[model samples]
Target chain A: MRDRLRNVLAGVLEVRPEEICADMSAEDVAGWDSLRQLEVMLALELEYGVRIPADAMLELQSVPAIEEFLTEHGAG
Target chain B: MSRLPTAEEIAGRRRQGLELTRVERPEATALHVLATFNLDLLPPFLTEAFDRVGRSVRPRAGAFGQLTQEILDPASRLYAEPPDEVLIVPAAEDLLEPLFSRPPSQLGPDEAEALVEERLAELRGLVETVLERLPAASCYVVALGATEGPHPHVLDPLAPERRQVELDRFMRGVRELRSLGPRTVVIDWDWHMRSFGWDAVRDERLWYLGRMRLNPTGCAALAELVARHAAAYRGQARKVLALDLDGTVWGGIVGEAGLGGIEVGEDGVGLAFQDFQRELVKLQETGVLLVVCSKNNPADALEVFERHAGMVLRREHLAAERINWQDKATNLRDLAVELNLGLDSFVFLDDNPIERTWISQACPEVLVPELPDDAAERPAFLRAASWFERIEATAADRGRSASYREQRERRQFERTSTSFEDFLSSLEQEAIIDPVHEGSLSRAAQLCQRTNQFNLTTRRHTVAELESMSSDPDHDLFTLTVRDRFGDNGITGIAILRYAGELAEIETLLMSCRILGRKLEDAFLAFLARRAADRGASVLEGTFVRTAKNAQVETFYPDHGFERAEDGVYRLTLTQGAVESPASIMVTVPANA
Candidate 1:
């Protein structure tokens, strides 16, 4: 689950895999704009094989929020 | 009839005209323009932009305000904008369905629902108005229906099903306008306006839209559609999507990344690249050639295709490839040459800016789409690009993906062998050529429009032309469907045989270039010769008129069993029997005309 989150974060930020961290939040990443936020949500859904409802995707702000939601939705 | 004039032809026409403004050209002798929209529905600026084109007018706007019990006769307005007097007539909206049956003050939620019903009713009226006001030989454009707001009101009625009822209703209105005749060309207004933004349409090219409104891309598409409709309406171009390895196909340069380092696995940015490649592979179902061109060594690229289980695009999927460090422009030229295609027929993609710019400067005819600066944008960018635009693909088109795959196998076979004739003979290539009947008319017409390289005379026809000809009782249409030892090449070639007095003339002879190397042309002419013999005709005639792209088959007549006649024409005598229907081939009856 951590690995998949890292991949989505890398794709959204257009950064190397090494640049991503587990503690990252929207403010922590330089590339996390509103457009990139939508992109990350889409990528996360595709990666984890889960349909994160539009509302849940909006509520997800930090890496921990995404991880907990993925657990709840059977993504992980 | 030949297929529509391409973008190049439109540009050529623009050059011939006296440039009144960058937008309007009046010098060309046959200058006519028509606009079809409720003028009141359009923002005023769009109408002004359209004024740049010669003699633009709309009937709906002038008549719209007066569509009440109070006003019986609608007014007309004229504007002198681009030195040409534009006559605008206000047609009575007897057809205009009222948006609100009751006063606006009396409207409730239910009233709003009723208002939508009334609007749809108005659309039917608009369709009737379109039929009455459509001008002769003038271009017509229609705006897509506007959604009332960001909310999904119209779609909600159809709901969960995504039934597209409102869309279909709008299309029905457009169809009624089209059924009126030649001058009506309906634009995909809804799709265009949403995608390109509305303001962009108003500011862009306007002449193509008739009097309707569209976004810039929609407007350009409208102009292209008009030009195509006016010239020859061929189905859309079947694309050969040539991809690049290293930087282009993946996130990083493959040559530098090595096999394991390359981005194409379950993790990292590779997943995005993998997803993109997989989508491209799916496009082969629609007959797009997935060819590979990269500066990496062929062996290294082959390693990715073979050993890498994670690789989405396999080696067999590519029809042709150029992996040498040769200039990509030159490599693309070689690929086209080997395949007997014009550079314009290709759409090249590479991630490296230097290589892309080189192709742009050198092979300017090829469409090199601008990739987004970021890696994540690759998928969305390609989805938006017009790389795949076929209107519809037949069974043959579906087989194209496999045919190209076999071509790669055939090329590998060629490398280890010596004699070209021996390779040709070993494949057991068989062609089934038959007279085009009502069942095969649509595919035959599509072939004439799409096939360029091996076409003897590039004549294009529409659905109407074939229908008219079938009814005429004077013409013969012949289609060829080939299946070799490898697989079925479904309707790869078509020839329209027209009976002129006692002579049979070949109006159009075209074959998909995928089956070019096989001796199918010989079999085709021989079959025609036998048909001529059976008919008691002495002379079988054909012509090899040259086009910019069809130079490959310029000597096609003389090379086969035909003699040169006066001025690029060819003739053959089939009084004697010709080659028997090649034993291995089977000609099946086409399912639909």
Candidate 2:
């Protein structure tokens, strides 16, 4: 689950897996913006086959939030 | 088509044309977009959409307003655009103004009928205007219906009935507008609405803030749909739908579980396979050739299509069947050769992921769509990809699957023949070479643009350009019509020649690969040489520009009694000599007639 979260973030951020730390947020990532936030949510939904409902994907800023979100959706 | 690209992602493709200024990029496949709202976010979505079909799209945007300027406007940014494909995405709100602004209860039937006519007429006029202005560009109109009516006003007694009438009238208007086919195609947003409903397509918040109405998902869907139209317009439609028998067409292994055990009946999970077969038959009716590639006894598999009561696709429905224990890739190659179609034209479907993976690695050109283990999702999975989209379905397109069957039977007869020449003479083939007219223009342009293997010089001309070439005295553009004993390979070959001074050059020479082994090229070239001599040409020169796929025709000129004048150019001196065609081929020249 952690690796998948890292990969998704890395894929969106165009950074290495190691570069995506736990404390990472939109401010920390150079390329992540509001538009990318929607893209990241869309990607997560496609990859996990579970659409993040209402404002749930909005809180997915840090790595922990994404992990928690995917785990709740029964996706790794 | 999978996911929309972020604005930051590939900032190069997104940021390149942000100025609304069109710059020409000759290499990449291009599409022009004319929209009512702000399409700032649509370009990257287009990039992502085109990426699915292995094409990188360079989209040129028109001015913001719908009726602002036509593509023919020299001052417009879209004037420099490729006239092959243009997308018209007029918002439904703009098209049907009164309907959107009012409640159906307030408006009586007479008013609704009047409004429908008004909307339809305006749409027709707009379409006609675009068609006249951009004669060459095939426009795909995104028909966004105002499907979301005002919430049921219970206070009004006859509101429901009026709404129904209004909806029917709207549909009739759309259908009538769409009837203007070939040059125009209306991509119904209803297809996308199925996945995400009207709530998702309409954006009230964005509508209030800016004129931009569609939500992000709606924008993505529209972009995907446009990209599909672009691919189809460029002759990239997948022609073959390859199906697997066991666990695919039916829900069981036919060898072990016999005909009765197969789950393709009127009930349970069997109904899913039944429905799936019906969908395939529908696709065949719309002109996609169906083929079965499975690993089972030929007779055993044949029984399913032969005798199954609930089966929608019978034995005759298939273009060709490869039902043996042979590997799929080998069978696929055999099918490609048999049908004379490129591997890129195939969409392979099998339930097993292993076989799909193997075929993917072996022949990456064949699209292997993933199918769920559950049979219910099979039809939807196959139908989801707009791989078989055609700009227009002519009579020739409809006869394609039957032509393949005839080719198969012809191939079988060839295997038992005494000699190659004997086989050639056996099939009585006749070719009618005529000037490119309206009916033949589309197919001629298709062969010109899409034909890579048999083409010399690989010159592509649009329909409008071909029309001019056909009319010009200096140019002779003819479509080759082939009919052997088996079937008519309609408008199979396209020859474009330029006659200037005493020398004539074969500007373009292409034949449909279906007629490859029939010794038609000899007849084709002979006819061209005779035409050139008639136009008072001293020499006929043909060039072979080698591409990755056209290596088979490297010695084309030399094989046909032409000496190499320069490196790639071959010259043949014109004489009152007769280049005898094969005895089987009876060439009909109108000049002789």
Candidate 3:
């Protein structure tokens, strides 16, 4: 599950999965801007078959937050 | 037509497209995008869509909600360094904020009507400004969609007071802007939304997060539409739709099942085939020449068009037919020759995977779309294919199939004649040469793009470029219209000549392949040489740039009393009088020319 989440994040951010650390957020990545953050949320919904609420879309900017949210929604 | 790409796939393509744009490809087309909302997510998808069609594009979006500023200001990024193409997307929610922010019940009928009119006028002004500022760019304006506004009653008829009705009025007004100019094309965003489903296209999460109205799926769909339009603008639109007979057009094999046993009536799967045939007929009406390339007995196939009660397509509907036992690729090539079109303009449809694969390998230029597995999905599949899209159909386009039938009659006349010169004289061909006018601009530009075999320098100039060239003093643009004993072939030839102090250079000279062997090219060139000499020129020069398809005309200049000079250039001195036109053709020139 961790590997899959990293792959999804890396795909949207246009980075290597090996470079995607759990602590990395939008600011830490080179191409991860606010527009890419929306793409990240949308990709998570499609990859995990889970719906992240609108308010939580902005909060899940870091890789760790996305994994935690996915686990809480039973997608893990 | 297969399946909409998933979010993960779209993400991967977007990344790939971004990486592709970072490289310096000199052949890439530049595209500028302007929208009413945050359209930052569109460039990558648009780049991928254009890439899928074998075209690379560099897309840059303007600041959000700056459509008006970009159009009005001459120093804006859109006008500073103009792009090859422009895409303008306007949403009803952003354009009509006052009406949407309030309830439909609160707004009066007169107030809503006035507001809608004012907004549409503003949009028209912006589009006109863009068209004037970027005369050489192909602009695509997306019509307003009913993405916002309160839901009305299920069975309520549209009224001016209703917000939904007002939005519909706005969309229709936008569609009429297609008449503003030849280069302006209005995309029906409402139709795309209804076809793709409203729920699947819009994402509330993205809207709240970054004010983006469309999700990745919607973005991909829009990108596909714009890319198809761009390809059509570049003259990549297909002209011929070639189909196979048996299990492809109808159900079952005609050789084994016979006419009575074939499934093509108004019942179950049979109805599907009938509907599919109807779609093909629609395509035929739109000037796409339909031809049969089936591997069956000619008599057997002819009987289906003559006697089948369920057949929607008749023998007259087909511009040409190749019902032989030959290979599919060979049949398509023969059809291209018979129709006087390049193989790149042919789109082949066949249900058999083996035949499709064969044609794909043999003739790489032919577009062979994969038909759906289910028979019922065939009609929808044809509707979704964008290879036959055109921005606007000219008069010549609408009369193409009928003109091809006339060409068939001319071929029969040629067979019975004793000699080539005798055939040319008996045809009584009359060539009318004139400067490019308003009515003939589209067809002239089309000939410049689509004419490959007989063209000397294959330069594909757009209508806007041709218009500007026609107004220039030192350049002369001429179109040749041919009328033989059989029929009027419309404007089938074009020539562009550049004049200097003492030299007249033939910049472009091309004729439609239908009029190739008729000595029309000789008459056209003779007329141009005389015109150049009359304009106080001492020498006439032409260059023959070799292409794969134009090898037959490598020595055309030399055959017409021209001496070969250095660098593949042919020179003829006007002091000795221009080369005389063939006596077989009666040529007429405009008084001004």
Candidate 4:
């Protein structure tokens, strides 16, 4: 689940999956701006078959937060 | 379903485009964006989309709030660097104010309707003001969405009484803009939001943060729509839709499975292919020439069309057909030569992945869209493609399939006849030289843009520009219509003459290559000479600018008694009595002439 989440975020950020970690946030990645945040959110939604609610999008700034949310939604 | 690229994907593509140092950008359509919201990302997205599809656009960033002032001011960047396509995306919040913010429960029905009318009138004026200033450039006015209204307005989209009124006003503005000219292409992204998701279109986080109206998904769709509009206006829209048979148009191969085995009827799995065929027929009616380039026995392919009880398309439905075994690439090239159309104008659709790859490598100019693996998905995927986008479907455009079919019949006659001149003479060809009318001006402009190989100057003009030229007193505009015994080719020639007293200069004169090799060119020149003499002009001067496609016409003037002057202009002294019309074609002149 972490590998998949990291890979999806990496694809959205145009970086290698190894470069993305659970603690990696917008502050760490150069391309991880608010726009990339939305991109990663949508990419994760498409990848995991889960629609992250608009309110939940704010918490998805970092990879760890997304992984936790996906688990709560019963997504891999 | 079409995948809407993530905004990150769009950004990455834009960065990739910036790295393309040697890639040639064809038809650099200068674009200006005037939005009520922040469109900081739209420019790159638009450019990237344009680059993807045969065009390259350079947007003059995007202006906010003071759109009217920026457009009209000569010293402003809008006028200083005037664009070819102006993309206007007015927000509902900016166009309609407090009334829009209020719920329908608060206002009476009459008040709501009245407010809608008042706001629409104001918007009409704003659009008109922009049009009047930038008369040359085309406008893609993005219709305002009513989704941004108050809680009830956003939540209760199905509340027809409230949302419908706002929508009606927005659509009314779009309708008025449509009436202005062919140049104004309306992008109905607002309507697309019904399926594109309101959440995606109106991302509240970005809207509040920086006035960014669309999310990444919405931005991708908008970029595609804008790029298609630009391509359509530039006259780069694909003309031919070449279809491959045997698991393509039908389910089974006609050569192997036989007619009964093919799944293309009204029932069950066959319904999908039938529905797909119906869409192709619809596209054919809208000026797209349909041809067959299948690798099968010609007899077997014809048998499928003839004997198949489920087949919707008949023999006459196609402009040309090459159902031979000799590879698809050669067949397409032969079709191009036969139809007198450029290979770039073709969009080949074949079900076989191997055949698609072959043509993609061989004929890179032809647009072959990625088809779904399943037959059922092919039709839906085909219909959604932007390759056949058109600003307006005129009568001439609709009659194109019939015209191409007629050309095929003419070719048949030409073969059977003894000689080329004999074939033309026996056909009873009539060339009518008449003043250009309102009905034929759109076709005239289309001919000006599309006709290249036999064209003298190879100049492209929009419908608006052609209308302006036709109305100009100095320019004597005449369009020639040719009709043989086979069929009417329908306004195949255009001659625009610029007269300065006795010395009349040929501003524009081009004929459709479809009507070439018919001696109509000779007749067109004769008509021009007569018109020049009628106006007491001594000489009819013509300028033959060299273009890659028009090299065949470089010696056109010298061959037609036009002596080259020192200024590089072709000069032909007018002699009313001596100017002889071709005996082969029966030339009809105006009664006064």
Query: Residue-wise lDDT of candidate 4 within B1-593, one digit each (tens)?
Result: 14566656755764564444235656566888888777755666677788787666777665677666766566777767768778888777676665556666776556766777777776567666666676676777887576644445355555643556665665666656776566677777666556555675556766655567776566667887778766776676789999998888888877788878889999976998998898989898898999999888888889888888898877777988888889889999999998888898999998788989999999998988777878778777877788888777877788888888787778888999998878989989999988876677667878888888888887787765776676688888888988889778788888888889889888888998888888899888888888888887899899898876788889988888889999999998887543567899899987755
Candidates 2 and 3, the one with greater DockQ: 3
Instruction: Candidate 1: list runs displaced more than 4 Å.
Output: A1-76, B1-96, B99-143, B149-186, B196-238, B265-271, B306-311, B408-430, B434-442, B460-467, B532-537, B547-568, B578-593
lDDT for B43 in candidate 2 is 67
Q: Pull out the clashing pairs in model 2.
A: none
Give me the candidate number with maximum lDDT: 3
- Candidate 3 stretches with Cα past 4 Å from truth are B1-3, B102-107, B150-155, B159-161, B575-577
User: Positional deviation of B396 in candidate 4, in angstroms?
Assistant: 1.6
Tell how far residue B12 is off in model 3, in angstroms. Answer: 3.4
- Give the candidate number with the greatest DockQ: 3
Candidate 3 matches the true fold with a TM-score of 0.94
Give me the TM-scores of chain B across the candidates.
0.68, 0.84, 0.94, 0.90
lDDT of 2 by residue, B97-189 (tens): 666567656766688778778767876776766666666666678766654554444545346543555655665666566555446667766
The predicted structure with the larger DockQ, 1 or 4, is: 4
Per-candidate TM-score, first chain only? 0.86, 0.84, 0.92, 0.91
Report per-candidate DockQ.
0.01, 0.07, 0.78, 0.11
Candidate 4: clashing pairs of residues:
none
Q: Evaluate model 1: give its TM-score.
A: 0.62
TM-score of 2: 0.78
Model 2, residue B103: C-alpha shift (Å): 8.2
On lDDT, the stronger of 1 and 4 is: 4
